[model samples]
Target: MGVIGLLMRPSELMALVKLKKQIGVWKRRSAAQEKDADWEFCFDMLNKVSRSFAIVIEQLGDELRNAICVFYLVLRGLDTVEDDMAIDNATKARLLLSFHDMIEEEGWDLHYGYKDEKVLLEEFDRVVRAYRSLKPQYRATIKDITRRMAEGMQKFTEMEVTKIADYDLYCHYVAGLVGIGLSQLFSGSGLEDQGIAQDEALSNHMGLFLQKTNIIRDFLEDHEDYNEETDTRRVFWPKQIWGKYTDKLENFTFGKNQEQAVACLNHMVTDALRHLPYSIEYLSNISDEQNFLFCAIPQVMAAHTLALCYANPDVFKGKIRKNLGECRNTHPVKIRKGLSAKLMLETTDMQATLSILEDAIDSLADKISPTDPSARETIEKVQLCRDLIVQGRRSSSPSSKVASTWRQETSKATSYVAEQCTVPLLVLLFGITAAVDVPQALGSAWWQSEAVPAKLGPVHVWLTSLALAFYSLTLLLLTRGAALSWCKALSAAQVAMTAAEVVFSPVVGLSVVVQALPKLLLAAMLPSCAKQRHSRQLFAKQQAAMGNRRVLRPRPIKADKSY
Candidate 1:
């Protein structure tokens, strides 16, 4: 079965079908008459090395597609060298620094690496030949990036990365350069704005975001077994971040430290997400639809992967890749729509933009039944986006607008106080019921004369006391944010107290039922309260995990008169 075959959802299946159809069209159009054996070999290598990328690369127009295929293979060869630990440090460093120069050397290749990548290294002459066949500008761009990346890899291979900056530098060398190179290719192909190609900061962020995600996701695999001979692990997580959490990077994966591990993972995800706005900006600037998709597929996949990694303990246990079906099924286009809505809101009237967003969300719900879990999540995220916009607008206004904000805050405070007091109110009611029943149970003439059972006095007192104790305990648990199981148990005890009252005295039983109703309702709501508490705890943990790192809260858009 293909990757998409793993837990295939209907929507995802449809998306995969559409993607395949698009790929088919590109393949048909790019089909060469009397195909060159060298070009064919390059594509074959792409499929073998990275099938996922092959799908996207194949969708490119003929010229750009071929260029990218060769570019990918060249980088794959370079990466193979960096990954192969068996190569002596001296040889690896030398080859890396000179690898770019060898592109024009004819018949240049490396034979030593992991089994899967070794073939690419050995057949790299074909990649270099294809590179040479590209236009001079494309060739120069590829060579420039390759040379710089090789040097960076050489430096890191020989030294330890003890700081976050060093880690970013290493990522820049390995992946950031690829982003720069691709931008140059896009610009050289006359498909994207030339200015975008020169925006190194944006390009660097694009690469760093992707590289950090890969490093974070592959933490377990990368640190599994250090080179036994060298007693060193192949890790990209900056010591600056992980060192604060644990003495050994591997400890984060331990069962006892899973919480810390998840926090650390969330922190890394947050760092990666910082680049999202720039990435969105990059996408917005792209004019070529196919090129945009080409760039978009990976960015969307990165976001989906980060979501999977968030608070996921299994990431430390082993590999946790999204199934092909799941990856294919993700609605990245919806995310793009969300970004557009945000941009529009920032540049248009707030109320008008929000109305448009609401309509879009409703339309989305109509198409994908709100009953669907995915649809619900999407709707929730979009609504959150809308709320964020409203909050931004409110926060940005002058002092005259402060009155409305104060009113909203006051109302929220009132609701919060009311919610918090429910348990205490239940406790008070339980105490009152117990007190009231004592007088009745003591055979007070007025109470006993009304059809009271002759033998019910002690039983009434016992039931009331038991209920009082149960309600007090339930209140304690609710205040402590105890599990739902405990709340249910307390509820069961209340039910028993009601049953005893009913059997002994109908009037008292009716009164007990009325008094116990609120407690029962509160018990029922505890589960939801527990859920909210859990969410708050998770958020707190995430913040703690981030430590001194500034969390990226979305900023409000300034209203534009342009609606």
Candidate 2:
């Protein structure tokens, strides 16, 4: 994480909490449905192979969720074949060419991929079963993309990525195809319109941008994978771009070639930046809010990653940026725990997601918190007590994101309780007082009496009851999150009833004011606008997004059913 990335303030922390809650709600909803072994195994494989993707996939509406999940697994299964260096050239090419057909085949499992990826390969049949269960449109989308991606993978497996066009073409085959497939899946769900998938070039740009970022950051890993001994592994950094700086692509990672490497890195980042406007335009077309988040979360993260990657020499060293491997792989430059949550929470419309992009662009442009050359992040200390403070205590821990989130949520809950109780408490006090005063009007005591209406007149009887009931309803509704309009109208009714109490039957003026003061206070103090305008709009959208978001519980193959 960078300097600014460390401090996750209260709002960002809360966003993370809310995101977890939203995901949990989806999970619980999924759990409540009829799931069989095949469905269970598919989800297990999904969460196993893809980390961030599984979470995002689970949040989609029911119809498309299963299909998207299957789509991802199929691609992961294909990627495994592509990544496994142990597989000889011919057999791997055959597997890559036929991956789409394998998704439909019964009892099809392979054993040649890497560690965790091998799990996906071994039980590939379960994913095939789940894939088969999807709607025909979804199946067609997955198969079509898979077939194309497989052909691309097969072609690239033999050919080295030699030029910029080839790099873009390879990404299109792998990651760009994933983007197109997702857009098609979104359309199939009926959550988004067919128009969303209509612009194929725009969607492809989204994938290219992300895929290029991955290739840039993973330069070390991919370059290391570049072997003269093995013809199978091809380094994705196109020679055409890197060739401008050095004779060899791997030389970019060497300290002696630092300047050339940075120049090359900047070149790659600049290439990726070309697609930002296209990505922004793509997100602008997505109308469904959940689908927007599903797409935008990673898009925003990509921008943040680009901000970190641009002109930074760390990616060439490999440790700061973990490339595609296990599901746990994350770039240190990432938004971290609260980052995804904040983007998901704060990004209401496309405008907000663009604002994040704008911030990243600013960082790249040196507009915000420009990096200082003299500032060293880590210094070798010569002595312990050289600073101004004589006795500095144990280092003050930066506020924990989890702890800060917990405290903020607790404080909100406490404040919510206090807010809910305040008006209602006053209203209840006034209602009780007014109810007590009805018979007190008959007697001497008003503020002094504990009696109900015993000998009051018909007019006073109705007045007291009206006043009491209005107060009760106002308070009751307020605490229950009812519209303030209800309380506003009831306040008007209470005022009229109290005025009649004073007009006909109230013998004491002092008691009437005392008894009616709370409602009058409430009426005067009630907000003209209920909640803050933005908050109301944002939370309303969040409720719609989170509220019973249907995750398709495609039944587990309960019996020993096979294709």
Candidate 3:
């Protein structure tokens, strides 16, 4: 509990408090009374094996909860056997393939395994007894999935995976199968649509998303066996990806190849994001509120884990995890919004990367100003690293080179005058367009005629002025590389300006479009600029590598905010 308290973020602490209250209410419910001795023992094993999952599982209704509980224990036992490197390859393979068959036999248990999971392994017979007590449909679904999963694990045990496709296949066996099994149970309990269970692709993505994230997060531990002397290392990273970055997977952990390691990590995170849509769809299809929550909690954690692991060098040095407070505080809504924003930015590619770096700097600066001296130093160092990266990117750009050439050709005061005049020149152009439109409308026969439209009276002048003001503000923000909120507001204002034009007169609309096109074009160029900046940064780093120079690694920052 003390270790948990230390690891938990403040938000996770609050979440734990709320969870305890909920569990108390659950204890008073009929669901708690229905638990038998075997079920209680099985649940205790679940807690020991996975405390986080146990919290979500406890919130479920009795029949479904017990079914999932048994399902988890059965898989846990099988995983224990697969993970025990002490077991010979042939023997382990045989046991995995036949593992499902053992569940039907009364009092069947395997105690030889990892010390932490030994309790569940030794007492697995009780889990089998509990499984037998489940309704026929639940038993059938769990048994089928267990058999398929065991078969898949057996296949992988016989050989090492060398390709990305094979890695995905291996993940499918261990995790995707669990997703399918859960969907079956959800359908069997009449809590979700039966169609959901049948959608193998969706179920597979849901499982693969979490599985890939875990694999990436565990790179430091999984790269080598606990005993380096006589044990073969367990290499789960697909050769296809890592091979591109390094000659050997182990090299990624070395300081010299830190950049490559981060690249590999980012590549993996991007791959995991591809499955997000399917995962969201699966969660959305679950109609029950409790069921939806049970499914969502893990997805949110996975999303946050990806975000933390993205640029952080800790993935290579050691295991990285979200604090319990952070994990508990993350909600499905927040994850969904983040995913949406991320996807939008991703579509713009390089521009989005630059935008993200810019945002990171501002965020770090805010934290640096209020922190203790030691913390401030760390924040400042990270900010400096980011600034260097940004500068490197700018130096590599053709536009930057052109600007440098122009500055070299002109005197400092002349260059300054040219820079100062550009904004005023554009504003004057827009102001003239506005001034011309008002007079043209006033002088037109449509304006002087008695039958002038009410919607197109003197109010048109006010709308035109308001639109001009918004357009000018948008242009100013775009020039300054504004925040995302300003960009969103600019987009909304553009819509309003267009709408106001339609309400005013055709001439007014035409004048607005004429003035707005350049601003719109400039707004569109921001992402391209960002993309170019990132490209230049990567190119500069590559050139340094070619010159046999060691590139400086970005220092890790201790920021309070989760990804």
- lDDT per residue for candidate 3 within 251-286, as digits (tens), equals 776344787777666666555655654665566467
In the range 193-311, model 2's lDDT, one tens digit per residue, is: 89777767778888988998877766666655533456433478888878888897657663447767777777677667766656766776687777887788788778777767766
Ranking by lDDT: 2, 1, 3
Best by TM-score: 2
- Backbone clashes in each candidate structure, one number apiece? 1, 1, 4
lDDT of 1 by residue, 357-401 (tens): 333333222222222223333434434544554554454446524
lDDT of 3: 0.62
- Candidate 2 scores a C-alpha RMSD against the true structure in Å of 21.1
Residue 224 in model 2: shift from native, Å? 1.7
Candidate 1 stretches with Cα past 4 Å from truth are: 1-8, 32-34, 254-256, 319-563
Q: Worst 10-residue stretch by lDDT in candidate 3?
A: 324-333
**For candidate 2, which ten residues in a row score worst on lDDT?**
376-385
Candidate 2 has which clashing residue pairs, if any? Answer: 36-556
